[model samples]
Target: MSERPHMSSTSWRRSQPITSGFGAGWVLVIFGVLAFLLPPGGTAQQPPDPVPPVGVAPAAVEAENDQELQTIFRSEISFVRVDAIVTDEDGNALVDLTADDFEIFEDDIPQKIESFKLVKHTGVFDPDLPPPGTIRNEFDLEREAAREDSRIFVFFLDEYHVRDYNAMRMMQPLVDFVETQLAPTDLVGIMYPLTPLFDVTLTRNHEQIVHALRQFKGRKYEYDVLNGYEAAYAHYPTTDVEKIRNDVSLSALKALAMKLGGLREGRKSIIVLSEGYTDYVPPQLRDESAGGGGRRGAMRYNPLAGNSRMEESTRLFQDMGMRANLVYTADIANRNNTSFYMVDPRGLAVWEYDMSQVPIDHETDQSMLRILQDTLYVLADESDGRAIVNRNDIGPGLAQIVADQSSYYLLGYTSSEAPTDGEFHEIKVEVNRPDVRIRARKGYYALTEDNATRLMAPPKPEPPSAVSRALAKLAEPTRSRLVRTWVGASRGDNGKTRLTFVWEPIASGQSRRDESASQVMLMAMSDNAAYFRGEVPSRPGGTLPLAEFEADPGELELNVAIEDEYGDVLDRAVDELVVPDFTGTDVALSTPTVLRAQNTMEMRRIAADPDALPTAGRYFRRTDQLLLRGEAYAPGASPVDVTARLLNREGASMMPLPVELSAGGAYELSVQLSPFPRGDYLVEVSAASGDGVATTLVAFRIQG
Candidate 1:
């Protein structure tokens, strides 16, 4: 396998807002997904052997609830969507093309045409929306405003195959593609090959998104200077090249596919930016050693290279309104910036394109900007996106991809393929036209149990309602209300402090329940305000259930923040917890308040509700006949018996003091800071409750 070839859900966000009309689209879906139970000539049913993707199936993946699963099945048909720019041999959007101009294929088999319609982000009520800044939220309704509601575009830039120099060269075309191709409503994210490592930033704002793209260099890791073997240092090798570089990349790819599958809209486009990868010896674990998950035949540099991922990655992309667009490189230039050569196998550059013919755009080429673009056509072609050579001509290729408004046709067909094992098949989309080349999803994974399709079975697709259309333009997640989260602090087995987060769906402020949109989330901040290193998912459906995760107590210190399903942050709570896991220290503190009332000889006494006391008025009379004193105390500490000696500016006692404790040991002390007249009185007391507890007591006067 040429190291260069290839490229590559829903659980985190709710399918749609529930209150919106159930609508007829979902009710009238013609191409209901047909499950291929037994392959064409296969046998009877065998009990599904539970699979723990990482082994320990039971512990790894929670058991599925049949009833709950069924409920999710009946929900709306929320397919993932992908926003694509399909073009012809010429670089022009084929927008005028109709459904018939396209053919649909999956896993190398011809599929029956199902529901097909041209989607665009038009017809809206509210126009003004927030700009894309940073990934402040998970769902950006502004970005979702496009009305197409497509799946995400995950750009997997394979770093293992490309050298740092060539890698730098690819950014030019990518920058142009983002600047011109992506609409204001599109949400683009960049990722490298690794697990739990994603610079996943989402926003509807074009500027913010573009800024993020420019910052994407590549994955940089630091390996231990020592060899990593032996039990002594095996379990937690921070930089075990094999573990960090191999399966992790696969995990990122899987996540990309899942992100597309999770969309509740049309189609998805996942633009990969790397060569591709293959497993090393002993075939790294899949599920179980028995047959385990899928494995590469060898540690092939680029298994599937340009053509491999298109089949499945493209299919998954389409299922979720996603279409794959790969742009990997094939060659590299030396540091001298003088010549070119084949990338060394160990150099880490995977995908390559044909740069034999690259056009130059005036926009780029500033300064002696040393740019070297590698041609990565195989990847781009398979993804149904255009490829380019490094040079000045990237504009034309990118323009073609975004401008491809070709006629799209939706087809559906049933297959006799078995869903038991993960098998690969080939698909071809041919039309009876001369000089016409049809590009569609190569193939999809025949049903795999415990996976997405087999799990919740996407919600039914609903035609965009008037409000849905309006809100789609304004912001996403109009249906998702605020999320109610409870965070607790505790200690882990390692003796380190930990903060646990438990989240549940809350009412979206709208009063109604035909069906409500569940809140899905990707938590960025912990209860203590610390940032998270990995991504956290917030799936909306009630049946999918709430999830709990433990983070280092340090994360909680970031000033707790939460975002709704549409990526809008609705709340920012303070860290009020006193637990060790929350504050990082074992010291807990509190305050209690006390007050006094009085009547004066020369003034009239008044009675009113203490709760209604004017925060700034002195309506009641103070008795100078008696002195008043007050003080504050702390929790688990001695009660401070401090007395306040009342007086005028002349330092004379006015009256005795009365005190009261406020709620939760927190205090607000008040005394008469007014005037008396001809004379004054004095009162005092000094005592401690115990245990070095601090107290607050002061003397003041009322002037005549």
Candidate 2:
């Protein structure tokens, strides 16, 4: 019932370095509405639909066409999954490996090989997956009862800083790092945000990684502020620099991370790919003018935002038992030397404060670039993580990053570093050979994440209920979307009138965009009641275009109350609407008897978008229905062939209407109607579209 993505033409870029501090919320609280545990496996025995968590069932499992739910008792064992990349020491991605070739360790203590499986190649989620009877007891119902012991992710995209050419230069290293340097089972995703096409997607498959990389179009498309992606920035006036740049896209990064945190066995990791002071966000909207004044008129750095963002990025990582590693990227061409081959970390700088403009021109550039090379040493100098600074060795450099992402051993020890009840602890990790580099996260914020993850994770209660889900799915009434409302006046059969409103589909709440998924559920309510209902086949969620929304538009009634994902009723629409039933054999007429209203039957042509309504538009096409009720009725009240006239308010002829009223039925028909000019119009229903039914009279205005 749904469709796919509307691939737009935007590219990704490194965002301007915003310097404020804002943290992410908690993991558990954030994932409150998501599925806590995986569904059950199928058995020959059917069980009472596994009682939904907290009594809540899905709104309605969109029509299931391929599942076999017969006598099988679906086992409800939650499935745990994660993704990673693997590579050998020679900087080559290691493929064709089995689980037997690897070892598992949590907190440094090796654990048993519980489960292993390569991720699927396809990107879509299949309702009929893992097949039935697949869970052979890999789940621990008791352990899950406590909390999800899984991992979370940090999706870092370089949108503003990296230029196109420079970006292309880093692509190979980036991919190599993700595929060869990361672990074979670590979950991670990539996003190159300057372009909208640089969307975020998870890749458990190396093939997917490669495929996505190929789809990367080098040429940038033209963009205007009028289209998508502008509403957020246009309204949020973050004009100051003291704030972080996370809210610009309403990015689900934080939300997505929280959702993934519920996974059964993943680790916590933030894969950062930006080149900055790591997290050196200056406080306040800095006035680059005054050595330290806050941001200028329109652009100021966030005093607390930058540091806060870093704190959030870090704390979020810790809560999920993860650490962050920056695959610090720079132009290979701009490197101190285009060796195009081997290199050493000692030759570079660890933390480069680009003190370039002050004097030492050539000296500064060389020193800064070298400082970048050394930046990794300082990071890896003591911690398990190594910063790949101004890196020249694409193959080995990325291979190292991928290893860290996928298989680098995760070892946690009881920290001797106590809180100052608040104190930063210096963490340290090492491999047997000092000759080879062992990269890992520099430090951890310990319990600082408690507040972070908690704030983000909303409170979890019971699951949803069937009645609730059904109502949630029900699309009812005539919802008027500011941008998609199609309203006009026209006449019907019985010298009566009609108001046809064809609005684009509106869901109960904010709809999540699923690329390429066609089906969507639209719902509406009467401003008069508390229930929600859907019009049409109530198949609001479908793949048809907007033109498909109104086959024969009808309205259903429901409660006026509006609710959100949390089931919390927020507010209600202001005015109540009473709609006529188009289905019943008879309709109550709203016009007076012997109505001499002039009418015209006009055709409404959808010019721009047939399946959509604009928030604002000139009503350019409207068919008017002219009405005149002087046809003498025969004895015994026989049905009359109502001759309706579709005329302009000036009584001028417009279109010839073709409509009818059934025997013994009342109607609102059209004698003749044609599209009206961009303005107000009156509709007069005929005695029928042609026959016995009485006509209706309705009036409405259309905006240009």
lDDT of each: 0.35, 0.32
Clash number by candidate, in order: 139, 203
* Model 2 ranges with Cα > 4 A deviation: 1-29, 32-156, 174-188, 193-199, 204-208, 214-261, 264-271, 277-384, 405-443, 446-704
Best by lDDT: 1
Worst 10 residues of 2 by lDDT: 1-10
- Model 2 Cα shift for residue 220 (angstroms): 14
**Looking at candidate 1, what is the lDDT of residue 474?**
16
| lDDT minimum window of 10 residues, candidate 1 | 1-10
Candidate 2 per-residue C-alpha lDDT over 247-276 given as tens digits, one digit per residue, 9 for 90 to 100: 321132333333333333333343434332
Model 2, residue 131: what's the lDDT?
A: 20
Best by TM-score: 1
Q: Which runs in model 1 stand beyond 4 Å of their true positions?
A: 1-111, 120-136, 139-146, 149-154, 157-162, 193-199, 218-243, 275-393, 404-421, 448-704
lDDT, candidate 1, 414-518, per-residue tens: 443433344434446655445544555444333345543554444455532321222221121223334434333333445444444444444545333223323
